[model samples]
Target: MSAGPEIRTIFWDVGGVLLTNGWDIDQRGRVLTALGVDLAAYEAVHDEVNFFWERGLISARDFFERTVLETNPQLALTFEQLWKLVCDESKMLHPECFEMIAHLRRAGSYRLATLNNESKELNRHRIDSFHLRRFFDYFICSGYIHEMKPLPEIYRAAIDISGFAAETAIFIDDKAENCDAARSFGMIPIHFQSPAQLRVSLAQLGIAI
Candidate 1:
């Protein structure tokens, strides 16, 4: 499992790793309550609707409309309002994770890139506000590619752009399934749980912390 010194590319997941995703279940309940929707009533549908959107089976507009109708049937809110709430609640960058990225970039040992399942609006916001675009050699967003991961093509695209062989690339993702996908494609996969865990894993892979 040695990465060896030739490993020159690293791909990162956005949600749950770079950004905070899915509000605390408790906090989500509170928000639903404020919106006059019963937390338990909408929970399952909310989860399913998001899954559909992430899988690219449904458009964002359809997802938003369905969510408003199923979750807050009594409330009168436009699709714009629903979109803003959902995006704002799910999208937040962890400072510690950003600091680690800064550290990696400073080391200049790997070509950094992001492969994320995110909307264009959220991606643009991150690029501008986080200035994350400056740190990466490439940024591949699902919305832009029309291909969300754990798909091989998305990973291949990143690999091709960075000009790194899959065998010599490292991928960091919060989801076990996504990590497994990378591993299946012959890239070294690091299952990231926290900034500390990621640092330890990268160090183990001989990536300077």
Candidate 2:
């Protein structure tokens, strides 16, 4: 197997696979703790609004207003402040992963893209802030498509948008559910553990990087 017809494309997950999560549970906990916000109260509202929020149906301000702020009225954090905290969590970039992305690009071996579940603003922040466009060809984000992972719709959309047969593509993500979903869709799934492990797995498919 080579990086020719065998593996024509690579679909990466932005949050865990390529970068830190935009606003996952760990990131939310850190940001909320720093602001002295109640976790239980915040999660209650977060669960209510997150589905629509990530689907790009609501603006950043509205998402904040509906989530944490709605539950904790005394919290004086502004939308910008809260959004910044969420974006900052994604700043912990993985150098090895980045290097591999660059290597794949330089090899000109396959199509590279990102498939992630995040809000529009935070997704844009991570994309531009991390210069993801430098390597990835497409950004199949939940914000734009209104489809999240572990769902057949999102996997189908991603496969269609890539213009490659799912069997010829590889989907890399940290979540077992997401990976399982990809496998069910006929796309190869790499349950990303670390950069080193990822490299080994890809190497098995003749994708050196």
Candidate 3:
């Protein structure tokens, strides 16, 4: 039997794979507590608005007005203040993962891109603050593209943009569902655990850094 096509393009997920999640449930709880806000009220509206926000269907102002400020009127914080809390929590980026990316880039052996589900304001902040553009040749984010992962269309769009066969592209994400989606779309999927595990997985696939 023939071996699979050589992996030429690598797609990375931002939240868990690249850095800490922008505003995961734990982070939200922490931020809310720090601000002395009511958690129940925020959670009541979070489920309704978070996905839409991540998909860029709503602006940051609208998200705050509808989900946070309106839902809990007693909270005495501006949108920017709350946003800063989220940003603070997201700074736990893994340096080893970035080092690996740099090594791969220096080798000039693969095309690198980020495919992530992120809200518009948060995504913009993270990318700009970290200078992630320097590392990636392209970005496939839900905020700009209006599509989140575990969906076949987003995978199709990324594959289309890279101009590579899906079979020759590898996608790395922390979520199993997202990895499964990539596999279903004929892309090699790596379920990321840690930076060390990732190095091992890539080495196994003949993608040694």
Clashing pairs in 3: none
Candidate 3 lDDT, 1-209, residue by residue in tens: 12789888999998888788988888888987877778887887797898789889998878877877766668767788776767888774688999999998888899999999888888888888888888899989887778788877788899999999999998999999999999999999999999999999898889876
| Best prediction by TM-score | 3
lDDT of 1 at 122: 60
TM-scores of the models, in the order given: 0.79, 0.93, 0.94
Model 2 clash pairs?
Answer: none
Off by over 4 Å in 1: 1-5, 22-30, 38-52, 55-59, 69-73, 90-93
Return whichever of 1 and 3 wins on TM-score: 3
State each model's CA lDDT, in order. 0.74, 0.86, 0.86
The order of the candidates by TM-score, greatest first, is: 3, 2, 1
User: What are the per-residue Cα lDDT tens digits for candidate 2 across 90-174?
Assistant: 8655789999999999989799998889899998888788888999998898888987888888899999998989999999998
What is the TM-score of candidate 2? 0.93
Candidate 3 at 7: error in angstroms? Answer: 1.5
For every candidate, C-alpha RMSD to the true structure in Å: 3.2, 1.8, 1.7
